[model samples]
Target: MPATRRPIRQLPDELISQIAAGEVVERPASVVRELVDNALDAGATQVTVRLQSGGVRLISVEDDGQGILREELPIAFRRHATSKIGNLHDLESVATMGFRGEALAAINSIADCAILSRANGFAEAFLLDGRTGELRPVARSVGTTVEVKELFYSTPARRKFLKTDATELAHCIEAVRRHALARPDVSFAIWHEGKLVEQWRRCTDLDPVIALDQRLGDVLGQEFLTQSMRVQTIASDNNLRPRIWGRVGIPDAARTRADQQFAYVNGRFVRDKVLAHAARSAYEDVLHGHRQPVYALYLAMDPARVDVNVHPTKIEVRFRDSREVHQGVRHAVEDALAKPRSAGLEVAAQLDSAPLNNGFSVEVRQPQSVPMYSAQPGIGLVSKPEYRFGMQPDMPGHKVSDVGAIWQRETAPVADPIPQEEWPLGRAVAQLQGIYILAENTQGLVVVDMHAAHERIVYERLKNQLNSITGAGAHPRTIVSQPLLIPVTFAATPDEVATAEVHSETLVTLGLVISPFSPRTLAVRAVPNSLVQGDAVSLARSVLAELGQHDASTVIERAQNELLSTMACHGAVRANRRLTLEEMNGLLRQMEETERSDQCNHGRPTWRQISIKELDALFLRGR
Candidate 1:
């Protein structure tokens, strides 16, 4: 059976506005975000937000910026009446936050609203009421104030969807937090009921980077500042291009959730897929398991290249060239995290003679390197000889056959006095239980996880070898292969068989050879040299699935990296293995030169510093 369709007619203005309101206003937080956006677009330096009942009963935002004229007061509440854009050209390149101008009209249809403003150079102010459309003279300074009360009052169904007061209040606060993180030169304050909740003062530094760093400490926390690395880079092709700057947390600071990640394009906050995927790719090699990285990255580029009108909330954006943006962000983060943290540590005085508890303090002398007086002649306490891990005679990916032959050492004479300050890792003194290395430095004590440190060193070396063999130009490079004595067979689905046949050349470059044995089975003839001991069937299936869904070259490269990582893990030094002082110091020196040596291949810290102050507090000296 068929039913008759309703007649198409233009709805009344009130009914039309309520329908528009459904898209613009979701909860109290929605109203707060819109009002704050408008305030910021008005060039406000100081903004204040007041809330009651989690912003349902009352929400007021006051800002000191350019105000509107009295004659345009009534038309400001009309649909699509925006001062930001006039024609199609202006809409194509919008720099202001509130361009659509549907917020005021949509909000007025669902709640009680009012606007009081006084334009700069004007003598008097005016107030406009939403419900009555009444305009009268008012007393106010040269700025604007917008008040929204009884949100979703007209639509009872919408009001039922609200959460508790405390939960809603938390959402309101988070909305403000996003804006605060993007702008460091503006002051923001929030008040709930009659008490002040949160406030962020403006950073007065002349340098933008220094100001942003100060604001990050104030908003995120001092701990974040201490544990994260600063990223500032400009990526360009020909003329000026996008500039990226922010703070990325170290591998050890990764979080269990993605709530702390923020990305901005041209001073506007957005959550685009290209940015998210690029960030995740940059951290794929370092982070372990399912941990998420925390960062706040800002990108500055031409406004015409991005379109912000993709969503009603303006939180989603579209880029003309997504690949450029992806590579720029990924490389920026990678370069910032490449340098080892040990290289940045500064040497400080170990003991402060300031008295505590009115008692005398003991002065401790820094450990000095023995002047070429060790048991082995020509080898000083901390050797300056060249020590390197010897590669196999054939290829680089093979297992390190012997631990004893790993180091290639050469002795050199020491003329000048060498101190511990020159060696950041200090001199290796002893080994603990054959699993840890103990050392003394200018700062204090340093404990090294022997197995974890060696694993990272081996992993990095394997990557360099593979890169050199492949010519390191772009992806889809060839990997060296080794033939197996006997072929392995596996049951394959119809789709898997088809994928293997279609991408046969791709498989060959990755050092894999798979052929159809029957209608339902496949045979693996060869495998990568480093993954010779791995499961041939499982590796073939994983590669087939990835080639079926994602980009072939990317999937092949990732699979090759997985094989190298596995080889490095198994070839590292094992626990309960004894080593001499020379071997232990050799490992420490390698760690200092390796990039991202602070964390192992699995994102766990390989070593930690225990400053002298911590040691003093533990023993309660001078107390």
Candidate 2:
């Protein structure tokens, strides 16, 4: 028997609201995120959050922000009604964190919700019951307070999906942490099970940098500031306005998971693919394959260029031009991480400076170039007979030994003291274990990993030479390409095929020759000569993939860089090679002029300083 179809009907308001709630109120943490967004949007200076039973039983948020009017109390719980926006134009540039107006309505549909508020000029506060639509006079300060109880009580099925109490509480804390990081001027406090668990005090400093640093220390831990590098960049091209600034942890501080990574757009915490990919690409050379880079990066741009309405949670954003954002973030982070660790050494110097016994004040100066080694082939590697110290002829009354002739010729006379500001890394005193170079400076002692330092110097030189050869506007006599005898062919997606056809010129410039052989297959005919050791098929596939995703290809350059890195490592001076004092000092001088000389290709520190005060502390001096 054929069953008769039932007539379609519209859902009741209560049922419709519950369905919408399902999207916005997934768990306790979701509720916390919505409430906090509302508080911040209201211009709250201080916000307090209290939770019980992992916020499944009770969740309360109180903020000293502009409160709602008594007449608008009921409207606040109606879906699609909000004061954040009034027209379609307002939607294009939504600066506030919570503008959809679905948060209050969604929360009320699944839990017992109540809002208590007293407008600035109101004589008394009013309370509205979300479940019964009842209004009553209540005593409250000139702000807003939202209390939610028995989360998902109306939806038994949803309640069953929640995790254990501890896990939920942890997520709630993380939500608040994200907000605290975004607004340093706002104080935030959180309590769970009637105990204060975390607090971030409001920053009062007038200097933005100082305030941000203080807040970062308070939220990410003081150790993070000590171990991380500050990144700031301003980029604007055409109508696109982008500014990326934040702190990125050094490669040594990377973690296994991506939990510590944070990215925000227009002050709203987001999980954008462009931002994530940019950061990961920047760290490709430095971080281990399994480890994730950690950073708190904030990107500020005109709101009109980004759309936050793509998702119900508003945690994902769509940019008008993703390519620009990708370039901006990637370049900014790369430039920051590529700076020499000399800045840290300078800071250490200031902290370690003390009065000498003879009343000579030790002053640490900014790093400056000093003459050490005369230009010679393979100066960064083993010293050849043709290589000589630039200072060799300047020193008189010094005997040059065959084995240590370079060292004796360049060494300052025993009677002459080197000025404090002359050399930051100081003069080579001795070698340790044939691996480390020990030197003495005004502050204290300097120990350097000779192999690592030399590797970095060589790698930088190789990169610069490559850039000069292939850089824009440089006409090369011939492109260096290695033809693959087999002519590897592989299947390709339509987007990949299109990218190859469109960016073929770019590929040629990078020394790759790819052609579309069929509708869905591509043939790799040639690759960069420098990257001949790498798999041609894999390199072609990676390049196509990058072009498809980023509209830009870095595969060829990255592969060439990897090859150069290997060459540098092999060509660098090896441990136990017994370098003379002049060779050691030459490396030090080169490091000061080389970019990113602090860490090697593998991201390990090349040099470290030990202050005299630190040595004294070790020996318990003056105690």
Candidate 3:
């Protein structure tokens, strides 16, 4: 049977416009985004949004910016009419937020929309009905106000998809939050059901740095500013002109959901995959599994290098050179987070400076004397006379047994009376249950998981040694490979086999030898000497899986790190193991010098600083 041929006919202009609206206006939030983009593009300094019934009933956006001329009011709602870009050159280097010109036309199609505007030179404003094409003289300020009423009223099917008013209103608020964050100089206000919801005032300072921080505090709350690390970087390479700057929350402040991460490019909020992945990778060693990092990163680059027109809503962007952008963002975030923090000193200072009625001071008394353990030679404390491996006779008791004699020969004793500010972790005062180390610093207290801290220190040292042995730019020193006495064969997918073949050089560098034994099978010849105790077949498969998923440059190192981490965990001091003051202090000093020492290999915080203000609050001091 032959199918009936359908006639090709042009759709009506109204229907075409409505079809376009489906892509741009998904919900109340979508309308808010489009309208706000328009306002921002118009050079609005102050924007006000008023919503009713989650914008399903009405949405009013007023902006103090350059308004459309009276004659252009009618054309503004027509399809393909935009003032943002006039030619191909403007399209390539788009700086304005609303360039597509489809927003107004699409939004008007789904809802009853009206625009009231008075141009800069006009004496009076004019109003136009989007649906009826009716224009009339109206009195208004020298700005623009767009009113959208009865959203999806003409299409009951679409209205049925609307959620409860509260849920929709939350989404609308979130949309506004993104805009407010990107533009710290602009003031934003939101009203829902005639009640004020949120308002962010313009920053008073003209300095970009101070203004950004002030605005961040205003929008994200002061706690975020206190808990986050400031990130600012200008690309060092002459070829790349991208500048990335913003704030990333400390690892302890990680959230369960990714809702707090906000990224902007060229002052336009976007959810780009490259940017998200870059940020995530930077926190790879710090954040625990299933925990999402929170950050507000801004990237400034030549607009010609990015395409914001890829998405109808303008929330997604396409970078012309994704790798360059990814590296730039990753390096910027990594550099900021890698710097040693003064624990939570900034936060503690803020709390301490806060106004209080009572004028009482909290004091932290120092330990009168170091608790002396019974002189048990070679047990918990190693006295100077007992130090055998080139130990200085005048040295204090060193906890040699905990880390073995290797540390004794390598590290020198730390001088006494260390400055409080010089070493934030401070000197160890006592051990708790043989599992935790309690230290006193400028801050009230620092509690450390001894095993966790030691594990990280050992892991970092191992990696550094490996890097030194490999040397710079030379092929990594071949990890000694042990030939398997009995060859092992395993079934592999074609993709896995292809990955093994493609990354053969990378595998060799990691001391793995894999070959295709047959069409569907792979045979392992040798494995790294360090991982000989592990399942060679499984390790080979895991390495191949990693290679297929991530860049080859990092896959081998990551695989090696996992093995090193396991080794470190076993070598680190165990729980219920007593230590002398000297041993605990030595460990603390090592931690201060180690990179990423704040977290263990498994992304768990190794130590925490409790400030005096926090302790005072707990005791209800100066309430």
Candidate 4:
């Protein structure tokens, strides 16, 4: 053994700091979370967070709590320094939310950090500079105030990932709010870009929720909160007993993404796909596909069973018993969503209680002539069948009518009243209950629903051309269109104009080009090829309707889809009649070749998966 010595096994300081920073700081919100947690841990009854440009430029947190001693000031900036936990044994069961003893160290490495502190009886304040870990005595201060300046200055790459100032500030406020809710005894305040964004009076009761609703008025706007539901549930197991408490908004209440589904594991906000997905699945039966619900679920479990120490920033947790947690979460969310609307504030299903003959309108005594465009007379979930375009298992299957002589029984209807333009596809043999048309064809039997057929046609056109056109414009989307001589005008608000820009190109592709003729007047011209000249204004208005009704990121595509869907609805044959063979067969052939024939333009499926063999087995004629 010739002096076996490992030659300088060491990692770079920069690399070490980067790795440490990974655990301590993830985003701007993470920075606020750690500071807030530390303030609460210090026995602070009230804390205020001020941000400059979404915490990217500056983040300052002040707390009126028992401050640190002069001698301990330098150690607070060093790594592995904390008064929250004492030993390695504490790691096994972390009682406090922030006890990794790494947040300050990691944050200081990337952002310029400063901490000013003073004890209860101490007359003077002590300052700790993270850049140098130098402690200097200052004249006068009575509490701790931490200011994080030039956040991520050492890591420009990380700063690049931050969202708009407005969005980042929103995230910062949201994080603070969630904790404020968890610790109702503590008060929280927030300021962004010098403007006071939100403030909360110290209250332990559930009333803070209403105040939060006010702060997030734009996101949890009245429209979304209007459909909210309250939830509470419990779970018990061999080694752990957990309770989940919070309110869950309906699927329609979600803003844009699943980001609205907030969950706190032991008072720490976490970002988890599994937990969010489980919460989403619980509401699938009631909401549309891919549409998430707004929820605030707090999981209080044995500290030992749930580990929040895997990362420094702690936006995720490792559940010792995920199944128990999942079950509890799913049950709570489902139960909340299932509950009927609260008394006196119910969302009416329909304006009229009864149905009228001819299926044209309701309220026969008034003698109205309006047609029932939706399944329900007015806008309601029950009337908007999610599976009307196809078979989604979310809704019932549709029957095809009329076919070739061999399938002639299905197509018995389209004998009259259809426009001359669509008559050439095939003779409508039958109109099945006014919703479907059975047409006979030489190649195969075709079954068509007038509504679904139109949707398929429009969806294919949009799907094929959308991606290519969205990025070709000067402003993220190119209008491949020409403006009209006299711009069609519509009254709208500033928010609507902003939403319109996101979908502006999609509007052009759908054959309309709009611009703000005035702050409130939007000028529209041209229309989709499928839309008649006179129908342009109402169709445009309807597109706006669908846009407002939906929480879509791609407002333009959503608006366009709405227009096409509306066209499909109007073009779809009225329900309750008979159809012929030729018309139904044509529909079947068209659906087979159409892209996404499985789902109509608005997310409804168009076909069922029942195999021909299954049809034979039903009759006891199996081979």
lDDT of each: 0.73, 0.74, 0.74, 0.57
Model 1 TM-score? 0.76
lDDT of 1 by residue, 463-557 (tens): 66556644357664555555655677889999999988988887777667889999999988876554443457776887787678755546556
Please give each candidate's TM-score. Answer: 0.76, 0.73, 0.76, 0.51
Indicate whether candidate 2 or candidate 3 has the larger lDDT: 3
lDDT of 4 by residue, 375-429 (tens): 2222211111111211111112323321111111112222333332233233334
> What lDDT would candidate 2 get against the real structure?
0.74
Q: Tell me the spans in candidate 4 whose CA falls farther than 4 Å from its real position.
A: 1-23, 120-124, 132-142, 152-171, 177-181, 204-225, 234-239, 342-623
* Candidate 3 local distance difference test against the native: 0.74
Off by over 4 Å in 2: 1-22, 235-239, 343-385, 388-427, 440-445, 469-558, 609-623
The TM-score, computed over Cα atoms with residue i paired to residue i, of candidate 4 is 0.51
Model 3 C-alpha lDDT per residue in residues 1-623, reported as the tens digit of each score? 01221221233444334322328898999999889888887778899999999989999999988788887888788776777665566667888887677788888998999999987767989999998999999999978999999999889999999999999999999999999999888899999999999999988688988889888889998877877788898655663557999999878778999988999999999988999999999998777698998899999988999987676777888899999899989988987776545333334234222233354332434467766432232333322422222111211233445233323313334334345454677767778766788888776677889889887876676565456565465656555555766667889999889988888877776567888999899988876543443455666777787678766667656676764565455436667666767678667766776777878888887887766787787678999
Please provide, for model 2 over 58-110, each residue's C-alpha lDDT reduced to its tens digit, 9 standing for 90 to 100.
Answer: 99999988788888889888877677755567677888886677789889988
The candidate scoring highest on lDDT is 3
Pairs in steric clash, model 3: none
Q: Which stretches of candidate 1 lie over 4 Å from their true place?
A: 1-22, 235-241, 345-419, 469-558, 621-623
TM-score of 2: 0.73
Q: What is the lDDT of candidate 1?
A: 0.73
